[model samples]
Target: MKNLNLKSLYRQIEREYEELRRLNKRELEERKKIVYAQIPEIKEIDDLIKGIGLASAKEQIMNPSSDSLERANEGIVELRTKKEELLKNAGYERSFLDKLNSCEKCKDTGVQEDGRRCSCMENRLSRELYNVSNLSYTLQRENFNTFDLGIFSREIHKEEGISPRENMDMILKISREFIDTFKINNDMNLLFYGPTGQGKTFMINCIAKELLDKNVNVVYQTAFTLCEVMEDQKFRRNEINDIKYRQLFNADLLIVDDLGIEVTNSFTAAGIFNIINKRLLGGKKTVISTNLSPNELTKTYTDRVTSRVFQKFYPIKFFGEDLRLK
Candidate 1:
C-alpha cells in the first residue's frame, strides 16, 4: 500500500489507546479503593513501596550507586510481596489492584516498546480499513467458504477445451497462490474476463476475503464506483470521497469489477489508466473483472490501458452456464 493516510489511522489508534488507558486507570483506582478499605495493611505496604520507589529515583539521580539501587529494589520487592500476602489474606486476588491492559503486549499503547506498531494496532487498523471500504456483508456471502464448485457444469466448455468445473478448480488454485504469495513482490496481477453471471466476481470476492482476513488492505469497487470516486476527487471534495480516492492507489489490492459497465468517457478512461499505471509503478497488485473480452476491452479503453492490462496482468477466463440462474 502507498503511504496511505496512515498517520490518520495511527492518530485514530492513538485516541483509542488514550481512551483505553483512561478506562484502565479509572478501573484500577476503583480496585485500589476497595482493596485499601478492606485491607488497610495492604494500603500501608503500597505507600511504603511508593515511597521507596521515589527515594530510589532521588538517590539514583543525586548519588548513583549499584549498592543503593539494590537496596531500594529489595525494599520495594519486599513491600510488594507483603502487600500481595495481605491482599490474599483479605480474600482478594494479589493482582486485583494492578492496572489491567486491553493488550498486555503494548500496555494499551498502539506501538510496542521497540517503536514498532503492535499486532493489536495492526488488527485494529485492518478492521478500520475494512469498515471504511464497506465490504463486509457481500464478502461474508461470496467468500471461498460459500463458493460451491459443484454448481459449475462438469461438461466441457468446448471453446475453452476444459470443463467449467475443471477450469474453476484451476482458477481456485491460482487465486490461492495469489493470496499466499501476496506479501511477496511477485508482480502478479489478474484480469478476470468473461460474460456476466459467470464466477468472476465470486472469485474476486473470495480473494478479497482471504486477503482482508490476513490484514492485507483491499479495496473492492465496481468500475462505475471507481470512476465516481475520481469524479468526486476532481469536482466535489469531501472527507469520505477523498479517503476513497486515496484508497484507490493506496490499498494493497484494488479490485475493479464490471469494468466495461462504467460510462466510458475520456475522463473515466484517463482515470482508470492513471490508477492502473500508478499502481503498477508502485508494485501494488490489482484485479480487474470485466464482462467484456480482450478485444472489446481494447476497443473500450485506451491503447495504453489495454497494453498494461494485457502485458502485466495474467488473464483468467471464466466460461460456464450462468451460475446465478441455477
Candidate 2:
C-alpha cells in the first residue's frame, strides 16, 4: 500500500456520496411532484407532518416535557397512516413517498453511523483503483458466472492425453483455489503459459473478478502497457505515472497478460525482472499469462528474469485448439 494516496480516495468518495445524496433528493422531489399532482390530500398530510415536527421541537425547547413529544409523534403517525392508505388506494406502494437510498446500510453516504467505511465504499475503491483499464466492463462479461466449458473441445489432445474441456475444468478449479486462498500471503504466483485464444486471459479475468468483488486491489495490465508505465515513470516522471508505477508493486495482485507480446529489450527485461522480483520479495502475488513457452521466455528476457519466474511461479500450462475458432 505504498503511496496509495488515500486522501485523494477519500475526497473522491466524499464527492460521490454528495452526488448520491443530490440524486436521491432529486428523485424524491420528482416522486413528490407526481404524487402531489395525483392526490393533493397527500400533500396536505405531508405539510401537516412537517408542521407537527417543527411545533414539537419548539414545544420541547420551551416546556421541556415528554408529553408534548409523545403527542406530536402520535399526530405524525396518524397523518402518515392516512397518507399510506390514500397511496395504497390509488395503486401506489405504501412507502412510495419515502426518500430513496442506493445503499440503505449507509444511506448512500459511503460511511456508516458508527464511523466505518461502508462495503459500497470498498467496491468504489476497487473500481477506482483499476479504472485505467476497461476492467469494469470486461469483468461484467468475463467472470466466473459467464465461464463456458462447453465451448472447449471435448476431443482428446494427442500430446496432453486430455480433452480441452477437461483441461479447462481442472484449470478452473485451480483458479477458484487461487481466489479462495488469495487473502493469505502464501507467496503463490501463477504463470499461465499457452498459445493465444486458449482462454488464458479469460481465466485471469475470472480470478480478478472474484478477488475484486471481495475488495482486493487487483491491477490488470497487458505486458506492453506495463512496460509503458515503467518507461513513462523512468523517462517522463510525473504524478500520474508515478502513481501508476508504484501501483505495479503495491497492488494486492498484479496480472501481466500477454507477456511475450510486448517489445523486449534491455530496459523492458529489467523492468519485468524488477516487478517480478520485487513482488516476490514482498510476498505479493502475481499472475502472468503468456504465449511463450518457458524456454522461449528465457530467450526473450534476461536469464535473471526467467530464473525468478520459474522458481517463484507455479507454471500452469494452458493447451488446446484456438477457442475463438471453435
Candidate 3:
C-alpha cells in the first residue's frame, strides 16, 4: 500500500468534525424546545441555575470569605439538583438537553486532546479511500473469488502446448500471489494485454478489490476517461488544484483499462508516458489492461512510452476466447 496522506485525511476529518458539531447543536436545540414545551417549569429551573451560578461567582470574587463561598457553592448545587429532578419527573434525562456528540471519545473532533488520532478518524480515512477508488460498486461483483476459470477452454493448443484453461489457471495463481505479497513486491508492475473479453480487465479488478479491502488507495480509470480528465485539467482556465491529476500520480495503485482505445493525440501520448515513467521512478504500482498487442501499443503511443512499459511492467499476455460471449 502507498503511504497514507495524513494531511489530506486530517483535513477531511476536520470538515466532518465541524459538520458533526453543527448537527449536534441543532439536535440539542430541537430537543430542548420540545422539552420546554412539555414542561414550562424546566425553563424556570434553567434560569434559577444560571442566577445562582452568577451570584455564587459574585460572592466568591467580592467577599472571599470561606463561609460565604461554602454557602454559595451549596446554593448552586441545590439549584442543579432541583433542575435534574424536574427534568427526571418530566420523563427526560438532564443530559438529553445537552449537545450529544457522535463520538464520545473525541466529541466528534477526530482527534484527542493529546493530539493523537482518534479511532473514528481511521474509519473515516478508510471510507475516504473507498470513495476515491472508483471501484466501490464494481468490486462487489468483481473479485478473485468471483472469477470463473471454467470459461477458458481445456483443450490443448498445438503451438502453445497448454490449453487456455491451464494458461488462465497459471495467471490466476500469479495474480493471487501478487496480491498476497504486495507489501514486499509493491514495485512490481503488471501489464495485461490481449484481445477483448480475455479477462484482462477482470484480473485487474480483482487486484484492485483485494488492495482496497486492505484500505490501500486504488485509482481505476479507463484510458479514454483518464486522458479526457488530464486534457481538461491542462486546458482549463481555473487555477484550482485538480484531484484527478494528483491521484494519477499519488494513488497507491493505478489501473488503466482499455489502454489502446482512447483518442490518441500528442497530449495523450505525453500524459501516458509521464504517468508510467513517474510512477515507476516513485516505486508505485500500476496495472495496464489493453486489447492491443505489443506492436499495436508501440504504434499507438511513442517509442519512449512503450520502452518504459516493456522494461518496467511484467507483461501477462491473455489469450483465450471471449469470456463475455461464454
Q: Which residue pairs in candidate 3 have backbone atoms (N, alpha carbon, C) closer than 3 angstroms, thus clashing? A: none
Question: Which runs of model 1 end up more than 4 angstroms from their true locations?
Answer: 1-15, 19-134
CA lDDT scores, all candidates in order: 0.83, 0.85, 0.76
Q: Backbone collision count in every prediction?
A: 0, 0, 0
lDDT of 3 by residue, 1-326 (tens): 13446577677679878998998999988987888788887778777767877887787888776466677678767876876788888777867765598888888888888898665665555445435444567877889888888778998967778998998998888888778877775678888888898888888888988987886667788888788658767886232225556667877778888888464677786787788788888888888888887777777765665576667887888886778887
Per-residue accuracy of model 2 over 40-142 as CA lDDT, tens digit each: 9999999999999999999899999568899999999999999999999999999989989988989998889999867677556655655734677888999
Segments in model 3 whose C-alpha atoms lie over 4 Å from true places: 1-134, 237-241
TM-score (C-alpha) between model 1 and the true structure: 0.67
The best-first sequence of candidates by TM-score reads 1, 2, 3
lDDT of 1 by residue, 1-326 (tens): 33447678777779989999999999999998887787788788888888888888888889875477799888888888888788888788888887799789899998899998676765566556436355778889989999999999999877889999999999999999999999999989999999899989889999988998887778778888788779988897765556667778877889999888465788888888788888988999999998988778777775676576567888899998988899
lDDT (Cα) of model 2: 0.85
* CA shift of 204, model 2, Å: 0.9
lDDT of 1 at 260: 89
Which consecutive 10 residues in model 2 have the weakest lDDT in total?
125-134
